[model samples]
Target: MKKLRDGPMDGDMNGNQRTHNFRFLLALAILTPLVVSMTVMGLATFHFGRLSVGELTGTIVQQTVARVGAQLKQLQDVAQDQNRLNLKVMADRPPRAGDFKRVAAALAPSFEVNDELDGVYYGVEATGEFFALLRGTNQVVNLLERTLDPDGQWSRRISRWSGTDWQFLEQLPADRYDPRTRPFYQAAKTARATIWTSTYEFWPHRPGDRRTTGVTCATPVYDGAGQLQGVWGVDLGTIELCDYLAAIDPEVPGYPFIVGEEGDGTRRVIAHPNRNMVIDARTGMLFRDANGIRDETVKAFLRQIPGRFAAHAVHTASHTVPLRLSEFAPDSVAARTRTFEFADHGTNYLGGCFVTGRDDRLLIGMVLDKKEVMRHVNRNAAWFAATFAAVLVASLIGVFGFARRASRPLVELQREAHAVGRLELAPSDPPLSHIREIRELGNAMALMKTNLRSFRKYVPADLVGDLVRSGQEAMLGGERINATIYFSDIAGFTPVAEQLRPEEIVEHLGAYLQAMSDGIAQHSGTVDKYIGDAVMAFWNAPRPNPAHAADACRAALANQRQLDRLNEQWRAAGKPVFRTRIGLHTGPVVVGNIGSEHRMNYTVIGDTVNLASRLENLNKLYGTRILISETTRAEAGSAISARPVDRANIKGKTTVVTVYELLCEAEAETPEQAELRRQTEEAFAFYQRGDYARAAAAYREILQRWPADGVAAALLRRCEELAAKAPPPLSQDG
Candidate 1:
């Protein structure tokens, strides 16, 4: 029509051009709905294609890390627990060569080797057999002993004749337990720790013919002279531990796997899906591979593997690629390997090595990506998707009444997609869509993009966000954080519990945790976890707490204040009130979710937890309300009100981590109490430094002034004894 206005064939041409433009606009109107529908479908595909798998894998990895960390920590706990008992034993009586029997007897109740026993046993290099406590009975069982010798591997069996209680006997070469040479013996003897040994002989062939085995945990025992004595420890059967650990993923149908490397055979399947496939879970006994199983399938997977391992590694570097087996998916999706699992059969090629430790041998491997065990089903789903798309496209051509209605839904979906594509994390409060599914999807997308802003209130939003993107962050695992630990418990809770109804008890406990949690948070601390009525909190993790020590001290004081207030209220209501004892410590610990995938917890662990608990209980001795470790006092400087209580070792820790009392703002007698603390510190230091004369004089003056000082009394008695004995420069050197 405009061209006609330039002077040729005017009216008719103008009408024709107008008609054409109207048709073009109609076409655009129809195309708008189709384009939007396709865009919405594309967005959904993105989620299905990549995000879903990534989310699932991330969740699994987090859980796996947490579970593995916990299991290893439990092993550490068992070692430390036994070490404590051994320490007590050494303190009570010197280690004599003949004390092995008594020691083994003492370990009988908890050291059994059965399904429930969990491969708990102690071994001594002086003796030629490994020791186990019989299940449900306090009987010492010898796994490999010269007493049952004059035989070979399979000849060994469980017998009651060996002792008044059940005993197991297996024989092996003499050097395996020669106190002078065994790996377990050597490691324990060298340090005051339950040391893990390198890979050696894992299974004993006979009762007396002791052979080498894989890694073990050995805790040393000392005699009165502090001379090196035999070791009390636990031996882990790689096969057995692997089998039990393999059961961790029981929801999946296939057998779990543990892969390790024995010296002679480099590429072998150490443990497999079938419990009896290669070795017995209980005894590590060799079993025949049953017929009619998937031998080809197993071999096929193994054959597909590629390896350049640092031998075997549990803590493999991120860049390290072990035997990578493929699930052989078609090139329809952008995925190669979805998961990693260890071979279950005896000594498979894909094995985990405890690279973090001395030995470079495979301990075990897990079967990863079991959800896709049935590829056929996944392939069918893919095919069904493709067919559905074809039908959808063809239906667009029909343009029937129902088609338009269905297409209308797709049309609206497309419009929302375009709107989302235009919108971003800008601060505008855009109109939220009315459609429920659309609104939810849009919100989810927005949340993902703005997670840093959303979770900022609960966590240090920026740091956690970066960690998530880098895939270095884990929801279920814990890190070894530099933490100021705080433990607070209801002081007279036992008697209080007896007095209250069950519901009331529960109510009180709930109130206690909630109050503790709020206080800890306000001071920038995380509740590491709770133990019954006790609350354990920490600072400097999941967020930066620069004033962690100061905050920890403040929190302790706050809890005491809160508890005092709560009790006051309770007493006013005619309900009995209880006291709370708080303990704090600063140290490095392995913190994480301390449980399995299905059932897990975010918590902290190590000797730190034990020491903190010990500190809480030690309030009984000091008559102080709250106690902090010497480390915490040093870090807290003047911000925390504390006085060193002692330089003595706790029940678990080998090194003495001195503890102190934390004074609060509300105590008016704090200055006078602090002066008394100063005097006590000087007196204790004098005694510790071997100036017994000055120490005794100071102690006597303190007792005269404060008759109720128990520490002063005990120190006075010790000082007098030191006055009689040789007053060396200092006390015992640990």
Candidate 2:
């Protein structure tokens, strides 16, 4: 006599936990040896394979170093290409004072796309003038323009973009900084091609403030006549290079650095993995202070190398070898494309170097601690041995425990099925199972029980039982049965969705749908589908409901009442209220499962379904909530109050059908509602009879009483148009 509930299973099954545990223990005993054997084989391969573990580790380090070098070269190439393109665009026309803003706007896109570009500038050789746009922290963009005034001193103006437009920040007094004197300008002007400046401190905002190490990519600008107009340059920050390396593999015990040859041929650290090493702490600037070179690992390595190369020296030997500037000479080992191992601080390390830039003055290198690089491999080997033993023990315990818990649900399901076979429709809940197959079986059994109890809501309970007992399948074909179809839509739902946030829309729509579904279920109706804020349903499908029309009418009425209560609650909470409209039609239509084999929906469809949908839309025209066809009104009898609204051939149909507005429940109609319905019907009747003047008078009266009555207003407008039109074109044709 136990009944099922909605949710997970209720009670434990007959099998004891100890019995299932024993089964699991037996399974674990069978699997443990296979797992251990696999682990041992893998460890043996690592220890004595053709490719030794050390070689594999070394290959990985070499590949990583190569990738880092490639990325740095690619970055520089992008900067060069960007500068060359900008210079071409700017030099297309002669440099003019008025064209500075337009040129900067053109270059803005390049800066925006390349996050590493610190700034872009154009210098004019014809005039002592320079224009630049710099990107600052937190999305701040600053424009700097240096111009020579009548007094022969440089004036600088700074401006910032204020989202919509540019706003002038300040104008500084004359300064001596000239773009022609800068290294980037001189190099590009001399080469007449793209060139990279040596890394230096770039502190454009305020002197002695925060400084960052960066290099500039510059290209000479030429006018149409082939005259050197000026130099165009882009500053690229090296901090991004450090960040790029840090993000490569933080868990690895290695670092990357870029060393470039100084003007004096001495190698200087340009980009370091530890950014602070290249930054001068005193001024917070990069490569500005000599003390900044202290503690820099690559510089330290270079310093240890003797000034002169020893003859026949073994540079590739594992023993510590000094890395001097001479080793980076054209044919030295440090400049060659290879990796070497050396000892540093009693720890063996591996270093690989690659030449970068067209000038071959830059070496991109990575140094990894030998012990740290092997740490993971060594730890993994130890973990493999310990884990195999522990897994062997734990598997036996876990399998036994899991087997006991997993079997209980299947046992309980069997008992429930037995009870169901004996005509005992009600049975205790099946136990939940964690195993996939067992859970699926439990779910099937639960679905069977639910169908047995709730089938009457969808079809006649007696017929369902008969089909089950006879073991016969319901045929796929539908029958022409007199049934009532209902459709409801929330008004202004699109706007409502637009106004509410995503979560709020979900919450409000959920509550609205649940309220409507509950109302339909209360009247023994079957919900077909929900399309957004609309619901479609029907009654008397597989079941013979003699009062299906009345039932649908009652459900629609109850649905409105539920919405009214919800609207009241929403209004009190300062939330928007949803107004719903319902349309109902009763007719002989095909009702059955209709769709492809993979997916089928047991619903009603035909001209009757379309009519119901159209009727729902008609509510908007009449300014009413619910509308029904003449057939539904007749079948519904006096249980519901309705008034004739209009008769028209709806779209996709040739025959005209009469439609009525559902006023309310017969007993719940207010006196004022009754009076409104009477007046509306009277006006509609007068308009239909071709009494234009009287109809207009009647509609006017109705509008005076209910100014918002859309139907009345429409009819009144039609009557006025008819009266205003001259006698007729028919008389002229005659």
Tell me the tens digit of each residue's lDDT in model 2 across 1-734: 35433233434476544332345455666667766776678677657643465565556555665556556656766777787678567656745556777777666666766876778888888886988888866857777788777887677888776554557888876666678888888888898877777877664544433667678888887766778888888888777766655566624677767666665565556667677776566765566422347554565445444232121133432322122233334444332445667665576777666554434556666677777767777787777768767876786677656555545666687687775655467745557766677778877887888777776455534445556766776656678898899999999899889989999999999999989988987898878889999999888866788989989999998999999999999999999899999999998889876776666557788988888999998888878888999999999998888877777678887988888888788889899889988887887776666666777888899889889877778778888898677342232245
Give per-residue lDDT, candidate 1, residue 520: 86
TM-score of 1: 0.38
What Cα-based lDDT does every candidate model obtain?
0.56, 0.72
Structural similarity to truth (TM-score) of each candidate:
0.38, 0.45
User: Compared to the true structure, candidate 2 yields what TM-score?
Assistant: 0.45
- Highest-TM-score candidate: 2
Clashing pairs in 2: 20-404
Backbone clashes, candidate 2: 1
Model 2 bad stretches (over 4 Å): 1-44, 49-53, 88-91, 109-113, 149-153, 201-213, 238-240, 287-300, 303-337, 382-734
Candidate 1 global lDDT: 0.56
